[model samples]
Target: MPELPEVEVVRRGLDAHVTGRTITAVEVLNLRAVRRHEPGPADFAGRLAGRSVVAASRRGKYLWLELDGAEAIIAHLGMSGQMLVQPEGVADEKHLRVRVRFADGGPELRFVDQRTFGGLALADMVEAAGAAVPAPVAHIARDPMDPAFDPDAAVTALRRKRTGVKRALLDQTLVSGVGNIYADESLWRTKLHWARPTEKLTRAQAGELLSAATEVMTEALAAGGTSFDALYVNVNGQSGYFERSLAVYGQEGKPCRRCGAEIRRDPFMNRSSYSCPRCQPMPRNPHV
Candidate 1:
């Protein structure tokens, strides 16, 4: 799945080419593409047609285009989704799901998803934290990279969780944009076991974990985020190089970068977690 850095790169691309453009036409190549638009494809196309995109914004892993009205087109790139901006006459991608053409005859905005897990939706905006965001996800917590993120408040809240540290980090209500890969990387950086009890962490330790997450993600954002496969790429179809710099996420049975001990992979919530066994020892009585 695309995380904050990967999604932010796409948002930046859209802001560069798609913002300020008036939608002259909308082609829903597949009904599943607009599955999130509860009013259906016809309404989706009708509602988008003359509205100009004012801005391309993102909240954590969520991306959206704010239109002239108090509505926006929200997108979530579920596993294998790509937002591409191509020349008008370019060939349609093999999995092209939606296409948006502009009135100015500029390059077209294309949404392509191989798994179909991603979709588009028209959402009304609601005021939250002095900014307008899609009403459905207004309750989500601000991410570490977000300017509005409060480090003190985030650490305080994280220490209050009764769950395991990694589980708490994965909770969107607690902290946003962190997915499995980054979660393991952040833990590796902080030298904190994934199963450590959140409530047991000191305020300083909690803050360090948040700082680690921000540091690693900022680095990933600079590197254009991790891309182990072609499924995740920037709007211009460029792959990220962060995968080559990963510390532990997928380095199973490999030597730890810090202590030279073997890195380990353990089952975690239907997924897998990678860590340096010597650096991040398991807790005596790990919280569930």
Candidate 2:
């Protein structure tokens, strides 16, 4: 799952290479991955053939390419999907799932996915751009990175939740773009255990945790988003190096860099959460 930083990097790369280029043709190897006009794949290829890419942008993890006319190309890279600008060659036929060729012939924009979980949709560009798809996710408490972020607001959001802090962080509606890596890093920074209930924190403590969460995410984005599984890559096919700089994530059984306490992992939902036991002490459950 490419998070905010990964998606932002891909969006920037595509904006530089694909914007302003007029589409010469459309090729779809997997129809299930695309949603075309008229609700089928028939007019899809012809409708976008001569249109120019007016702009490119990203909201959350989805990427949008604005066309000169009313149409827009929307893509969700899911988990294993990757977009790259590569020269025309026979090798691309194997991995390339979709391509939008341009009139300039400079390079082909290809969507490649080993898992084939990614998807695409074509619709009114404005509708797609303005889709009721919940911008900035309402439940995300408050983004610590936002200049307007309010710690008081974050404390208020968490003051009543019964779920574990880590689980709360994973809730997209609660805080968009924060996944396992950032949640772990943020909890570790605040010295708050993942298993602790959100309501257990005092307002001051909750504010500290929120601030720490934002700091970790902002720094990670600056480092270009973590990439250890090769699933998250830029439009240019470059992997992020933030994984090399991670403090607790994927460092189980290793000594905590801060306190020398052994790093540990705990199962949460369908995935695992990592942390430093000494740094993030598990608090006792409150009286019912």
Candidate 3:
């Protein structure tokens, strides 16, 4: 699952290469690729042909290509999904699910997904958080990197949650863009245990946690996002270098960079959470 930073990197690439280009043709190689486009593959292809992409936009982990009309094409880049821009004569990728040719006949946009969990959908533009977003993304909260993101409102939303602090942070409605990896990193930076109760946190502590999340994500974006494997890559098929900069996310049994305490991993929501026991002391009444 690509997080906000990874998705943002893709969006930036699309903005640079795909925007302003008119779709000359669309080939849906797999029906599952446009499963969300309800009207079937023919209608999906018909609607996209000849339409120009006005902009490439994103909210949280959702990426979309705003078309000439009020509709946008939303891309769901599930675990192994990728949106690549390749030269016209390049060999098609083995897992290529959708091939989009432009009027310019230069490079083509390809949607390749090995796991087939991702898909494309045409959605009507709807107002969300004062911006025009695809209807499917209307309910999602603005991410920390969004220019209109309100940190104070986000802090209030975090404290309002009765769940553990990390769980609250992972809630997209509370604060978008913080996933499991970044959530642990943010908690570690704030010196807060994953199981700490959100309501127990002071306003200052909540603000600091949000700030840490923003800072870490900003750094991750600069490093092209953390890629642990080949599944996650940019439009040019380049992996991010941020994995080498991670502190406590997957550093189980490793020495903490700050306090020199051994890092530990705990089972969390069918996944894992890593932290330093000494720095982030467990709350007496842990929510977990």
Candidate 4:
């Protein structure tokens, strides 16, 4: 799944390419592409026909296109979803699910998803965290990169949880944006084991963890986000290079960049967690 950095990169690209453009036509090639709209594809295409895209916005992993009315087009870029901008006469991508043409008749925006797990929906705008966001994303907390993000409040919420520190970090309600990859990187940077209890962490330690998460994500964003495969790409279909700089995630049996200890992977929530045993010593009473 695309994380905050990847979503933010797509948002930036949409803002640059599609903002201020009016939708002249919308072709829903697959019903599953707009399954979240509930009213079906016809209603979905009808509602978006003439609306002008005011801006492209995002919260955490969610991306949306702000329309003229108090409504937005929410894009769910699930595991293998993509939003690609292509020239008008170019051949359509094999997995193209939705093609949006603009009044200007220039390049068109395409939604291509090989896995079909992603979709588009029209949502009403609602206030969330002192800003207007699609109603579906109202419950998601502001990310570390958000201008109004409160690090202190996030730290307080993180420590209030009884879960493991990494689990707490992955909680979108506490601190939006940090996913499995970034969480492991952040924990590695803070020298905190994934199973360390959140309540056992001092306020300083919690703050440092959040700070490291912010720092690492900022760097990842600069690198266009951590793409391990071709599935994750920018609007221009460019893959990120941050995966080359990863320290622990998927680095099983590799030497830790900081301490020379071999990195290890452990089962975690049906996935996996990576860490350096020497630097991030297991807690006396690990939560997992």
Candidate 5:
């Protein structure tokens, strides 16, 4: 799945290429593409036909195009989903699900999803924290990179969760945008095990963990986000180079940069968790 950095990178791309362009036509090539738009493809295309994209905004892993009215086109890129801006003459990708052409006859925006788990929705706008976000994303907490992300408030919310710190970090209500990959990296940077309880974390450690998440993701964004496969790319189909800098995630049995101990992978919530056993040891006394 595309994480916060990847989504933010795509948001910036949309701001550059799609913002200010009026939607000349919307072709829903697959019904699954607009499955979230309860009103269906006809209504979805009707709503966006003449609307000009005001801005491209994102909160956590969610991205939306702010239209002229109280409506926006929202999107969530599940695993293998991508948003690409290409010239109209370009060949249609095998997974091209939705295409939005512009009146200016410039580049068109395409939504491609190989797995079909990701979809678009035409949602009414709702104000949350004074930001006009699509209704579905109104509840997602601000991310670490968000200027308004209150570290103190996030710590308070996280401590109240009574869950593993990594689980708490993954909780969108407590703190948005920290996915599995970044969570491992952040915990590795903070030298905290994934199983550590959120309540057991000292205030300093909690703050440091959040800051580490911000640091690593900021670097990933600078590198255009960590791309392990061609499925994850920018609007121009450019791949990121941050995967080369990853320390823990997907580095199982590899030497840890700081401790020289081999990195280990463990099953976590049906997925996997990577950590350095020497650096981020499991808690001796776990919270009940």
Candidate 6:
């Protein structure tokens, strides 16, 4: 899934290319991927025409296209979705879901998703993605990138939970913008075990962990986010370089970067969690 950095990158790219341009047309190749408005192809196209994108912004992974009135077009990339700005004559990719042509001769904004789990919606509901708890974005407890974010706030949020540090960090409502990759990397950087329970952590430990998370995520954003699978790409269609900088996210069974012990991958729900046993040892006394 595209996290905050990737979503921010996409929003910035689209803002430069599509903002202020009038929507001349909308082509929906897959109707099932759309929601809230336009039950079919014709209706979808009809609803998008003549509207201009007054501005573009992102809250977590959801991208917002502000139009006239209180209406806005909302999009979520899910796992495999990406927004691309292609030249006028460029051929559309096979995964194209929808394309918007602008009246200002700017490049077309295309939504492409290989898994087709992504969706689009038209709504006057202006709630940011993080406002809804448990839907990925809302799970984040705190984000260091936020100007108002304090390391102490992050510690306080985790202090109330008994969940494992990894699990708590993965909760989007606790912090916005962090995904699996960054979570593992941040935990590793702090030399904290994934199995460490939140309630067991001291305030100083929690502060250190939060600071590491922020630093790791900021570094990833600067590098354009990690691209392990074919899922993530910049708006310009270039790959993110952060994957090479990963210390523990996907290096299971390999030697730890900080310690000689082999990295481990523990199964967690649908996905797996990676860490270095030597660097992130399980707490000697497990939380009872």
Question: Judged by lDDT, which candidate is best?
Answer: 4
Q: List the lowest-lDDT window of 10 residues for candidate 1.
A: 128-137
Q: How many residue pairs of model 5 clash at the backbone?
A: 0
Off by over 4 Å in 1: none
Clashing pairs in 2: 139-173, 139-174, 140-173, 140-174, 140-175
Model 4 Cα shift for residue 245 (angstroms): 0.8
Instruction: Please provide TM-scores, in order, for all candidate models, with all chains considered together.
Output: 0.97, 0.82, 0.96, 0.96, 0.97, 0.87
Q: What is the lDDT of residue 186 in candidate 1?
A: 94
Residue-level lDDT for 73 in candidate 5: 93
Worst 10-residue lDDT window, candidate 5? 279-288
Q: Which of candidates 1 and 4 reaches a greater lDDT?
A: 4
Q: Which pairs of residues collide in candidate 3?
A: none
- Local distance difference test, each candidate: 0.90, 0.74, 0.93, 0.93, 0.91, 0.77
RMSD of each: 1.2, 3.8, 1.3, 1.2, 1.3, 3.4
Q: Compared with the true structure, what per-residue lDDT tens digits does model 3 show for residues 1-288?
A: 588999999999999999999999999999999999999999998999999999999888889999988999999888788999999989999999999999999899999999998899999998876789899888889999999999999999999999999999999888888889899999999999999999899999999999999999999999999887689889999999998999998899999999999999999889999999999999999999
Q: How much does candidate 3 score in TM-score?
A: 0.96
lDDT order of candidates, best first?
Answer: 4, 3, 5, 1, 6, 2
- Each prediction's number of clashing residue pairs: 0, 5, 0, 0, 0, 14
Q: Is candidate 1 or candidate 2 better by lDDT?
A: 1
lDDT score for residue 182 of model 5: 95
Stretches of model 2 off by over 4 angstroms after superposition = 35-38, 43-46, 69-71, 123-162, 286-288
RMSD of model 2, in Å?
Answer: 3.8
lDDT of 1 by residue, 22-84 (tens): 999999999999988889999999999999999999988889999988999999898888999
